[model samples]
Target: MKPFFVILLFSFLILIGCKGEEPLNDSIIIEVKTAGEKELSDLINNRNGKYLFLNIWATWCLPCVEEFPDIVKLSVNYKSDKIDFASLSIDYIEDKENKVIPFLTKMNTTFSHFINGFKKDEALINFINKEWSGAVPLTVIYDSSGKQVAMLEGAHTYDEFADKLNTLIK
Candidate 1:
C-alpha cells in the first residue's frame, strides 16, 4: 500500500511539472505558400461558405507595412465560421523565406498567407480586379457565393475593417 501511494504521488508530480512547462517556440511553424494567378482565381471562386477577406500587400510598400497590424488584429477578432482572412504578398517569390516570412512572423500572423508567384504583374493585377490600379494594401471582401462585396484600396483602421465585416456578416 505504501508503494502504491508513492507511485501515485510521483505521477501527480510529473503531471504537474508537464502542465507548467511551455511549448517550445520552435514547435510553432509558419509556412507561407506561393500562389499564382490561377491559384488566386480558384481561391476567390471557392470560399466554402465563408466570407473571404483578402488583403493584397507587399513588404516593400510602406502603407502595407503600416496597415498590417490592424489587419492582424481583425484576423484575431473576427475569425469565425462566418468569415475567413488571408493575405497575398506581391513581393517576389524569392523573398518568401527572407522577407515575407520574417514580416509575417513579426506580425505574429497565424492566418493563411501567400507570396505572389505570378510571372506577369498585369496578369495578377487584372485577375484580382480590373479597376484596381495595381495598388498595394488593397483589401477586398467576397461573400459566401464568391461575389466581391467590397473593395477598399488603401490603408484602413481596425474599426473600418470591423464595420465592413459587421455589415456583411450581420
Candidate 2:
C-alpha cells in the first residue's frame, strides 16, 4: 500500500512538470506571403462576394499570441468557401522564416497568412486602416461587398471572437 501511494505521487508530479509546455512542430511547413501596401490594396479591392476576416498580429505580442488558437479555430470553422479568413503578421522582414513560420506551424494556422513586406511602419499601418494606430492583434471584418463592418483590437477569447464573427457573418 505504501509503494502504491508513492507511485501515484510520482505520476502526479510528472504531470505537473509537463504543464504549459507546448511542443514546436518542426515538420509542418508553410509559406507566409509578403504583403506591402500594394498587395493589401489588391486584396481589399479584389475580394468579391465573400465576407473577409483579417487579423493583423505579430509573434512578439503576447495578446496576439494568446488569441491565435481561437483565430485558428475560427478560420477552420468559418472557411473561405463560405467566408474569407486571413492573417497578417507585422514581424520584421528578417523574422518571417525564423519566427512567423515556426509560430504559425505550432498554432496550426493553415489559412491565408502574410508578413509585412514594406519597410515603412506608418505607411503600412495607414494603408491597412487609417484609423489603426499600428496596434497588434487587430481584427477587421469586411462584408461581401468589400465594405468594412467591424474592427476589433487586442486579445479576444474564443467566445468573444465567435460573437464578433457571427455578427459580421450574418
Candidate 3:
C-alpha cells in the first residue's frame, strides 16, 4: 500500500509540473482551445496587467489563412512580459477537431488559440464589436486595463501588427 501511494504521489507531481506552460522552441504544432463569447470576454477582461493581442479569424477565410503565419511569427518574435497574444477562430464548433485544429497545427502556431463557441454568427460578431462588418480577419488590441487601444481589419503585415502593438506597449 505504501509503495502504491508513493507511485501515485510521483505521478501527481509530474502531472502538476507539466502544464504545457513552457515556451515553444519551435513553431511546430499546438492544440487550440474553445470558448464562447462570455468566456472570451472574460479572458480579455482578465488581462489587466499585460497588453492583449487578439486576432479574430476563420479557417476557411482566405485572407485569414494567408495571414496566419505572420500572426504566429509575431507571437514568437514579440514574446514579452508586458504583452500577450491569442487567436480566435470563428469556425463552426462542430469543425474544431476536423478543420480548426488541423489548420492551426499546420500553421505551427505557438500562441494560445481559441475557437468561437457562439451558435449564432451575428451574435458573435456583435459580441466582438458591433461596428465590425462580420469580417473574417479582424484584429484588436487591449491595453493593460483591458480597454481596447487599437484595431485593424483585414489581413495585415507583420510590421503592421508589431507597429500597432508597439504603440500600445509604449
Candidate 4:
C-alpha cells in the first residue's frame, strides 16, 4: 500500500508539472512585407468600393487582446462580397511566430494576421490615420471608394462593433 501510494503521488506530481504545451502569450504577431510600398499602393488603388476594416493591434496591448474575440465574431457575422476584414498586429518582428502565432492559436482566432514591420510608430500612425494618436486597438473602417467612414479607438463590445458594421452594411 505504501509503495502504491508513492507511485500515485509521483504520477500526480508529473502530471501537474508537465504541461502539454508552452504557455500562450496573450498577443498576436502580424507579418509585414519589407516592400510594402507596392502592396499598400495596390490596397489603396484597388479599394474602389469594397468596405475595409483595418484593425491595428499588438500582442502586449490588453485592450487589443480583449477586443479580438469580438472582431472575430464580427467577421463571422458580416460575411459579404462588399466587406473585407484585415487584422494587422504591430508586434515586433522577433515575436511573430513565437509569441503571436501561439497566442492566436490558443485563442482560436480565425482572422488573418499581418505584421506591420515599419519601425517608426509615427509613420505607421500616418499610414493608418494622421489623426491617430498612436493608440493600440485602433479600428479604421473605409468605404468602398477608399473613404474613411468610421474610426474607433480603444476596446469596444461586440454589440457596438456589430452596430457599427451594420451602419456600414446598410
TM-scores of the models, in the given order? 0.82, 0.79, 0.79, 0.74
Error of 1 at 111 (Å): 0.6
Off by over 4 Å in 2: 1-28
lDDT of each: 0.88, 0.83, 0.84, 0.75
Residue-level lDDT tens digits of model 3 in 1-170: 99999999999999999875864333566667777867888878898588888999988899999998998898888886577889998888788888888788777777788988878889878877788898779998888787888778899999998888777666
| Candidate 2 to truth, TM | 0.79
Listed per model in order, the count of residue pairs whose N, CA or C atoms clash below 3 Å is 0, 0, 0, 5
lDDT (Cα, 0-100) at 60 in candidate 2: 94
Misplaced by over 4 Å in model 4 are 1-37
- Model 1 per-residue lDDT at 108: 84
Candidate scoring better on TM-score of 3 and 4: 3
TM-score attained by model 1:
0.82
Assess candidate 1 and give its lDDT. Answer: 0.88
Off by over 4 Å in 3: 1-29
Please report the candidate that would top TM-score against the real structure: 1
> What lDDT does model 4 reach?
0.75
RMSD of 4: 6.4
Q: After superposition, how far is residue 87 of candidate 1 from its true place, in Å?
A: 0.4
